[model samples]
Target: MGIRTLVAMLAVALVVIGALATQESYKVFMPGLLQGAVLTIEIAVLGSLLAIVMGVLAALARMYGPAPLRWLATVYVEIFRGTSALVQLFWLFFVLPQFGVMLDAFLVAVLALGLNVGAYGSEVVRGAIQSVARGQWEASTALNMSRPQMLRRIILPQAFVAMIPPWGNLFIELLKSTALVSLITLSDLAFKAQQMNQNTFKTIPIFTLVLLMYLAMSLVVTIGMRLLERRASLGLARGKAA
Candidate 1:
């Protein structure tokens, strides 16, 4: 079986085991965790959108923009990708206010995770764009198409297919990283689990539930991305036929 299948099966099995192990405690914990999960999903959705935008912009700048823009994009990708994500979060949340830039906790969490993941995603974008055959570029040039026109009309639609799988991986990584928001005082799933554990000392059941909840969320993202990949592949095929 594929890794996704394995992960989903493992998560389901754990859920069953947890349910059998702690039937009563689940009733007490599920409500709070579900509430926190809503926030986690919200942050992840918004963060993924931002990451897509940043990744595309940075990749284009590095590949096609003027010298200054290329330099700036390179710097951004290097700094964000090279540094620790936890430190990045701390800088945004704890250090920024000292400079009179007070962002909301939710906003900071989104920014930190989005920008961090976007840095890696920029490389994915660049590689996908590069993976397009050289002959396609030559054909576009023969038609005297401008860079933007060629990219929008020919290259990107094709490159997008290559991008989807890697982007799916990045999205799941971003989802897992949402747990970091709890350290910034955002009441995400991990935070709720910790709060419940502290209050009742039910560490095993609470953390087990937390693991299953996260696995379920990641599986949902995996399924969504797979559907998207299939749709994009179909669209590309249709475009070629036309």
Candidate 2:
């Protein structure tokens, strides 16, 4: 299997080399587009982190908070998740100033992406938390652990372990959604590709490269998430063991 994999990799390398050899021009358009790609990653990482925090907060509120807090959480989740993400971005970037709440384009993009994705993530968090066994909650109660303490030390750790895979999907979705920032004038991966296409009129090669770049970025996210999943699963196992 190792040798087969090695040969397969070599074959792909040769193909890429042959393509690059034929079109050394990929270097010429890469700089500006690559800058946009970097910005896309920055947005994705920040947005994903913010979304995760919002998700957990909202999920907890819906699950265990007082009635008003739960209602607020439900309202937030419904409004954001039901709306079109592109419209949300437009409203933030274009309309907020009239209402005296102006944020810069980049900040608006980040907030839009994070909040939109977080709405969906709230459902994921809710499901994961609810999936935990009732016995764990009873056991925590029997041990005299407070609600906050029990969630922090027992429920969240287990729920987070289960949430990883779904969270990974949400992360990828958030990453792809960053492309829409281009519509609001924030330079991102898709925006850069569009710029390259306009300048060079090489739409095929430009978008092909764009496809590969997204694939590469998604692979990186997938691998990182897989490692996290392993670590979380190990921690969960150890907790159960002890």
Q: 1-242 in candidate 2: lDDT tens per residue?
A: 23345345545644663475367777666677679889999999999988998998999999999999999999989999999899999998888998999798889989999999999999999999888899999999999999999999989888887898899899999999999999988888898998778888988777877776776677667667766777778846532321
lDDT of 2: 0.84
Scored by TM-score, the top model is 1
Clashing pairs in 2: none
lDDT of 1 by residue, 1-242 (tens): 35578567757865674674467857778889889999999999999999999999999999999999999999999999999888999999999999999999999999999999999999999999999989999999999999889999989989998999899999999999999999999999999998998999989988977887788788777877776777788855432321
Per-candidate TM-scores read: 0.91, 0.89
The weakest ten consecutive residues by lDDT in model 1 span: 233-242
Question: Pairing residues by index, what is the TM-score of model 2?
Answer: 0.89
